[model samples]
Target: MNAARGGGSVENGIANFAPLAATVFLALVMLLPVGTGVANVMMPHFVLIATFYWLLRRPVLMPYGACAAIGFLLDLWLDVPLGLNMLMLLSTRLFILSQIKYLRGQTRLVQWLVFALFTLILYTLSWFAVALAKRDWLPVEPLFTQWLVTTLSYAPVALVIGRLRRVMV
Candidate 1:
């Protein structure tokens, strides 16, 4: 009986960390060289997918602080303006957290649709922020391509995270 209780506790501890582990893992993916043939089509936003997934599915497990840390790390890894990704992620977290009461318990399709819409907004916001910081307007083509690719990436990435959640929780 003692062994069983210990095992349960151990499982619970690991379960608590599952969401965070998943998010960090996705952030690492953002660093990979997966650019497209297009002139400036950057890699899809893997970090956003993970952040949105955990934020929507298990907000308690994934805190805003952790999101900020991951965003900071991503900014460093991707070499973007310091705190740019951090601001983007924190804003996304806050936006979703505000609407989470309504989003919770909704069907997966609804969740995915909402996420796609959020991705659009996030990409635009990030693009504008970067441009404003640099004091110049960057072309929108690459940003649009990145947004489209990142939006398309949500389905597969969310499916993986959902499956992991089922096993972990």
Candidate 2:
């Protein structure tokens, strides 16, 4: 039966979890080792990209609770100050939701531009939070590099997720 009939099916349940599962998989991928060099510095925020794409394309699948859970997991794994990633992700979801009316139907280029701006703000805020927690000002270059890399990576991530969204959701 269909959801409109107030009946749920196994297929519907699996489809609903696809986005969250994909995002969690991405989070695990982010933890894999990358050899030292510029590649390390330029590592894209995989979780952030997935979070953004899912939040934009399927907000219901990526609710605030899921975001918090993902962020908390990242924080524990990465060993950063607790709640930093949570704050960033929650802020991202809130911003996207607020702008959904304007963002919907926009071209990929426009979406990329918006993501760039949003990533910049997120990275800047994260940098400040880390610096404050450590009681020392942190270097800005790596954060800037990560922001650029993450922003640039959004298009491909979005494309893949968009396809998944169509097929699954």
| Per-candidate local distance difference test | 0.85, 0.87
Off by over 4 Å in 2: 1-6, 37-41
Global local distance difference test of model 1:
0.85
Which residue runs does candidate 1 get wrong by more than 4 Å? 1-8, 35-41
Q: Per-residue lDDT of 1-169 in model 1, one digit per residue for the tens?
A: 7556665676778999998898888887777776566754467778888888888878888888898998899899888889988888888789889999999989988988898888788888889889988999999988888888888888999999999999997
Minimal lDDT window, size 10, model 2: 34-43
RMSD of each: 2.5, 2.0
Which residue pairs clash in candidate 2? none
Residue 27 CA displacement from its true place in model 2, Å: 0.2
User: Model 2, 28-102: lDDT tens per residue?
Assistant: 888888768654545588888988888778898899999999999999998999998888889989999999888
